[model samples]
Target: MFCCYESGFGKVNRFVALFARQSVVNEPPLGASDFKAAPLLQTHLLKHGQGGSGSAGSNFFRALALFGAGASGLLSCATIAYASDEAEHGLECPSYPWPHKGILSSYDHASIRRGHQVYQQVCASCHSMSLISYRDLVGVAYTEEETKAMAAEIEVVDGPNDEGEMFTRPGKLSDRFPQPYANEQAARFANGGAYPPDLSLITKARHDGQNYVFALLTGYRDPPAGVSVISASQALLCFVL
Candidate 1:
């Protein structure tokens, strides 16, 4: 079985952090070496000024302003070039303030219910939730009775009978959600070489999580004049409806 978790902090790191919290400042008296650079650095700084209380100072300010304008123009050009190159890396979506955003906030149950319904009616035909079971939905998206009823609706493949035959039975809370295809080869054939990925932990693997998924699902577009690209709808034409 595979499992995943984030290691936010370790014992050693925690100990160091605690020690840092209790730390007090201590200073050693400055030695001769500390003063060594002070006079020289001051002299260097003094040399940079064109003049003080003179026409030379006004000229220096004017030159400085001109240099600033030129530098700003170059920086803007570089910024444009960098943005053009970064454009090929792909677009970034603005962070949406979700309903459950803060540490104390909880997910919207209604939205969860609606998403599950959409997944069941549409995405389930192509995708699988292999890691999730009906029991997992209880109290999250549905009541225990509702989850059991949903589980029962799908016929599950079960163990061998007394005659040593594999049999189909009503699904139970313990049964994992079924795969659309029995195996990868069949899945590839059905989806034109693109095996639909399991939806379990799908968004978690993406950089922007569910927000990324929402953008991807809604970001379909026609390719530019001569460009061509295949999409899920094009590949799954047989099951698009």
Candidate 2:
């Protein structure tokens, strides 16, 4: 029985190692240092077998324990490699002084107003803010009268009338922000086969999203030596803050 258990343990270890190697191969080529032995081992057992009560189960548990040491070594290596890459690239972002920085601080109304102006004059040309209506801006950025006036500048397509035809009318406070293009196909055609993403909720979608936007807008610089800048007819606009 002891000899049989030893054989089973060996088989399981070899199988786990083989499985781990395949997983490493399938992972996208991050540098060789990104993979650690422990994650591979843990991943192997997680993929292969659940805890059970027979000799087979005992062998699996024992194999998992043996793999644990190597797994820790692997995790440490991966963490070091990641830290080195970040250091080499200088990818850390600069912090912004947001108006609502502290717990007690209220939003900076003036800054919000300025940002709205920038979005209207620049971002609105290409990106849509479909989730926002003119009425949504009334209390925060503009007065009711101003919001209504702004909405009136755009012509919205209304329903089929008695003639069963779509008709156009001046936009209302209830209408969504007008899209720059009629549809996705038109947008892509106008933008060199690339569709611009909507700006609505963009700040909420990414990690440190607000700072990311601030960094991107202010981050444009000459490319490093030997790198070439490929200019498109319509450049995506976030690079100028």
Candidate 3:
């Protein structure tokens, strides 16, 4: 019985040794770096999908890199757009009459006042200076009495309408400059083929505001020695509009 047990133990040892050798031969060898690189290769190849060649896997990686670069570019543009929106609109305005020279003058309270006077005397018949209120002129160094006096000159429209009747009221500090023409249609009709534009925000809206104004004011000519007369405003309207 001892001899039979010993023989059975030896057979067990032989079987175990043969199984270990077979396992070693069947299993593939892998290094640490190979293990790490395997997931990367699988991911790249999967993006290319089944039946994709090695070259296709490389292309997949290239496409992924381009997508990442494009995403980065979009992020950069968004940052610039955010910065631009945060910047002051007035400071970036093309028409804020500065760093340029013409008859309209630089941006200043005094220049605005002078321009207002010039506008009232020379340009107001056709154009409306509607963006500013009389109250805003207080910063122009006008005394209260002077401001009142100026206000008293213009007639304002007021009162409730049963008859839709018009009544004259003294201009107040809060009133914006009134329109000369009844509306855009009337303005266009009066100016031949062009419409008289509002001057209120002109200095803030136009890039060539100063030169354009200066040129318009001084551009009147006799056409030529024998040519027919054309209105200066007409000529200026052609260039500006």
Candidate 4:
């Protein structure tokens, strides 16, 4: 016998029992006539109201639903969880199809440049990369003069403190990025208790690195029947661009 609870407005109780008397050995050929045996006995108990008994069909269906629920619950409990996939149903090329291998390599310099442009226009409002010197922008193909000009635009304070008092500094690579909040605690408080993760090395640290980055940027979708997709506002990469 097994006992379980079914939750609705509150809770309902249920029980299922299975018993066998004796085992019978069967000879070969195993014809349908040779397999004649007694009918299996099955009972279902469901408590609905203060003083009420359920019909046979209702009890049988209830028992079936309970069994299905139990089996699904067991299977769900035993499964190992993994991150949801973002790949779509269609394929770009199918002749040499491989679910994992068939994915396109999406390293595009133009896209990275565009991403930088988007970052400067929007993300720079709340995030700053003090570790990334303007000089480092050269790696993204910016000219030396442009880098210097960009560096000069953001001033960094410097002076000797004879009296021993802290002063405001503009901005510098030596300084950590200027967070939207004073600290992680403050940031969490401001963003609905969700602390924004630092974006440094996000592209590199993610699994599959650049490919994952590209796919995630394009993954937002709508809800469906079994496990429908949802168009999400959440993403590490700036997908809007």
- Best-fitting candidate, measured by TM-score? 2
Worst 10-residue lDDT window for candidate 1 reads 1-10
lDDT of 4 by residue, 57-127 (tens): 34554565476577657645544232123233122221222244435753355656777778778766555
Model 1 lDDT tens row, 1-241: 0011112222223322332232323234223453342333333323443233334433443554465456556666887888786665365654678878789999999899999999989999989999998899999999999999999998987779999999999999999998888899999999878888788998897656777777667655554566544543322111121
Worst 10 residues of 2 by lDDT: 29-38
Candidate 3 ranges with C-alpha deviation above 4 Å: 1-108, 161-166, 218-241
In terms of TM-score, how similar is model 1 to the real structure?
0.57
Report the number of clashing residue pairs per model. Answer: 0, 4, 0, 2
RMSD of 4: 15.4
TM-scores of the models, in the order given: 0.57, 0.58, 0.50, 0.42
Q: Score candidate 3 by lDDT.
A: 0.60
Give lDDT per model, in order: 0.65, 0.70, 0.60, 0.46
True-vs-predicted CA distance for residue 215, candidate 2, Å? 0.8
Lowest-sum lDDT 10-residue window in model 3: 88-97
lDDT of 2 by residue, 1-241 (tens): 4355445544555544554454446533223233233244444444544333233533565567477546556666887987787666445566788778799998777777898899999999899999988898888888999889999999999989999999999999999998898899999999889998899999897546788778777666656656655773333333421
For candidate 3, the per-residue lDDT at 105 reads 53
